[model samples]
Target: MRQITAILVGAGARGRFVYGEYAKKYPKELKIVAVAEPNEERRQLAAKDHGLSSNQLYESWEQVLDGAVMADVAVISTQDRMHCAPTIKALELGYDVLLEKPMSPLSEEVNTMANASRKYNRLLTVCHVLRYTPFWSKIKEIIVSGGIGQIVSIQLSENVGYYHMAHSFVRGNWNKAEETSPMILQKSCHDMDILSWLIDQRCTKVSSYGSLLHFRPENAPVGSTLRCTGGCVVERECPYSAVRIYEEDDPCNEWNRFITNKLTPEGIREAIEHGPFGRCVYRCDNNVVDHQVVNMEFESGSTASFTMSGFSHDISRTVQIMGTLGEIRGYMEKSEIVLFPFGGEAIEVPVTVEEGGHGGGDEGLMREFLKQVRNENSNDDQGLTSAEASLQSHLMAFAAERSRLEGGKSVTIAEMMELQFTQVKGVASPNKVT
Candidate 1:
């Protein structure tokens, strides 16, 4: 295989995971030639960790792409809204791209990335890493193998788990709808994409209903203001206390503790006190819905309902598929599947668990992407999610958000493409449509 040089943009949480878990495991197929991050501390860390020279660490996407056009690929792990600029730039610069999901904040930007891939003859793949996960893959195989014959509908619910949701949305970048589009687009775009891929049908209509029912000052117990973990008398009783869990656990709390020494107790304290995670989970300025439900109609007459909630005990997903002949229910966290035949008894299927980021999907995706880019070829054997597939998933998310805002009106994929994203309509519009 040819050596594929890759430049990774962004050095945030997810970006670091991609580098450490995925790229670190596949040095032969991929090489980190450069990294672009505005934060000096992070850029230096990436350089030191990857053994790259100072010159290879750029301050922005433009600098990286300008100097590294010869780089075989670009891995975009930037902020949600910033995905379009680097992805479009990389494609135009003759580099294949592995873009992180949700493609971009707006449909038009996603469409632009699609156009650029075609126009530049660049191979662009979206980082819908869940598609590569073993459990999800098994579920897909079961459906494809007719375990649930003539699948009619699917119901998937994500346990967005209160503390996790509080950490991400209530205290993080996705606090408000306007701040980060809707919760659907920001978080569950992957879920929407997974459904589309599993059903093998076009999403024809989408209707949704949701609101910020919790995680507000109104929901806070009396006399308990911001910083529940810091000052609340009930910190020991509250499950969401950062002090009790994170501080007590020290190096054990998987979510709070950092692998590097830089993420010290002082850093955690400072972040929570002033940063997104530090605020009282119940007193933040969050506006995104704590719970949302989406009703979808497919072109092939199949239908599904998707629910996302910020309050749940589990962190994984559960799927129930109802079909003409039988039904399949997948418990993702436990890696167990139940198949209920229409007239016969139910059987349990066991699946293996692999240790790595994103249920072992991250490493697989990196391996496949590097293989394709190194060979400069595309094949079914690789099965990487293409730019088009990613856009379809993102568009479905857009439609779902529209449905939520407009009283659950059905939104067709065609309508979204034609009405919102077919043409250049935004300030950062790509005028030259490919």
Candidate 2:
């Protein structure tokens, strides 16, 4: 296999650990020759792991672009606000781009990137990794094979685990919608994308309702302090206790490993003492909803209801599809799928879970990106999570947020797209996601 060169835009969690590890594991398939990260620690870590020289490291994405086009593709995993700029530049520089999810928090930027990819005739693959997972892939296969008949309704629930909500949404990088994207866009766009893809139709209308119900100042225990370690009498009693979650210094702890690179006791304590993750979950600056429900109607007359809640014990997604002749139910965490055909015996389908993040979706995504860049066979079983498909999902998310803010008023996809275009072209457009 001919190795392809890649440039890393961000060396943070998803960048350094997930995609960067792919290069480390399969050096012949991908060689990360350069990296651009503002964070010193992450930059250093990525440098050492990728065996990149100091000159190959840059402080910012702009700095990376200032240098010669160094890679065949640019793996842009920067945060939501930082996605569009680097990705647009990378495409302009004749590099295939693998962008992180939610493309951009702003709808205009999302449209701009989509148009830019087409304008340049470059492959712009969004990180809609779920499309690449065996679990979802199997579901897609069943639906396509007529095993489930015509998809009429889909019920998908993203049970964002209690620990995860408190750690990432409530305290970590994505606490506030203003700083990041809305909870639906940042946390649940995968659902929107999958719903559209599985049904293979445009979302015509969407209405949603949600709020920051449980995590707030008034919701905090009567005696809770601003920080978790601030001598709150109920520290041990709180399920979201920073003490309980970060007390251990074990590096192997799944949650611990993601929070800090330094897994020592002193490191953990230092983080808890001053870091954002150490803040009281109920007293933090988080403004995103703790629970939400979205209703979608597709052009094919199929419907989907998505519920995302932070109260669940496990971080997983469960989906049930109702069809004319059969129904399909899947649990991503279990990697299990059951087909219940009307008047027929239910069958369990086997799934092969590859080793990596997001239930092996990360590896699946990287493999597809590498294949596309290598000009490998195009006629295959791979689903195209291309720029247009990604844009459709993003519109769904943006419309859902709009409907939520408008008191659950149904928004049309046409209006949403028009609104998106108006803003993009200095005029108003209208549509909603259903």
Candidate 3:
């Protein structure tokens, strides 16, 4: 296989750990030729790891795009709101893009990116990495093969663990809807995408209900301060305590790396004492919902209901797909899938859990993307990662959020899509067609 040269647009957690690491693992198949990251430390580390010289390092995405096109693909893992301009620019600059999800918080921007991809005739694949995992992919395979007959309904629950909720939604980058996006779009778009992909149908209608029910000020303990480092009385006892979760050595082996980049005890303590992760979960200025439920009706008369909550002890997705011939129940945390025929004994499918992030989805997605870039994969119709294909889930999420905010009113995908097109036409230049 020819080495596919790539550009790294954001060197943060996802960019470095998930996508950039792919080049390190399979250097003969892919090569990272350039990078653009604002953070000096992360930029330097990524550049050094990818063997990029000073001339290849850029301080901003704009600089990378403004210069000559340097590589075959651009890996864009910027923040939620920052996905639009860079992706559109990269496509316009003749680079295939691997963009991070939530595409953008706004439907108009999502449409714009999709339009840009089509207009430029460049591949724009979003990082809906869940579709690439063995666990989910096997389910999709079974559904496609008619193993489960026709998918009648799907019930999926994304149980965002307590400490993870505190770390991410309550205290981290996606705390506020105004700042990033609604909890549904920010966190559960993967579930929405999965639901649509499994059903193999476009969503027709959606209704949702949820809110910031538990993490508000009234839910705070009686003597709790705004920050966990402020000598709160219940700091040691509270399970959601920042100091307890971030400062101490994690009992859970999988979570130790997430607590602090500095592996030392002193480094962890210092991060807790100074960083945003140390803030009291209940006292933070978080406005996004802590729980939500969405009901979806598909074009083929199939239905799905997705539940996203931040209070589970385990941080994983559990799905139940009911069909005419058999049923599939999967727990992502356990990496197990159970099949039940209407009349026979249950069959357990052995799932080999991949050894990296997102149950090996991170690697799987990169593998397929490299194949496509190298002209080895041609199944474009089933390409779940493409921007045009991924937009449906974002529209579903937008409609779900609209329904949640509007008292669980049923919102049609047609309405959302029409609104998206109308907005796109309103903002389009004279030479651009709607």
TM-score of each: 0.91, 0.95, 0.94
Worst 10 residues of 1 by lDDT: 425-434
Question: How well is each residue in 1-434 modelled by candidate 1, as lDDT tens digits?
Answer: 67677888987777776653455666766778788999888888788767889888899988887753757888898887788888988888888888887687777778788888888877888878778888888888888998778879999999987667867777776777664567898789879988998998888888889888877677777656578546677666666666644556633256664323357888766655655565677877888888999998898899999999988875778999998889989878777789898899998877778766667777767777776776676433324588877777787888887777777777777877775544556534322211
lDDT tens digits, residues 34-133, model 2?
9999988888888899888899999999999875788889999998999988989998998888898979888888889988887777888899999989
RMSD of model 2 against the true structure: 2.5
Query: Who is ahead in TM-score, 1 or 2?
Result: 2
Rank the candidate models, highest lDDT first.
2, 3, 1
Candidate 3 structure quality by residue, lDDT tens digits, 183-290: 999899889888988898899999999989999898899888878888899888899877667656565433435556676778777777787778888888999999
Looking at model 3, the pairs that clash are none
**Which candidate wins on lDDT?**
2
Candidate 1 matches the true fold with a TM-score of 0.91
Among all windows of ten consecutive residues in candidate 2, which has the lowest summed lDDT?
375-384
Sort by TM-score, top down from the best: 2, 3, 1
Clash pairs, candidate 1, are 171-276, 206-411, 227-280, 272-278
Once model 1 is optimally superposed onto the true structure by TM-score, how far is the C-alpha of residue 419 displaced, in angstroms? 1.2
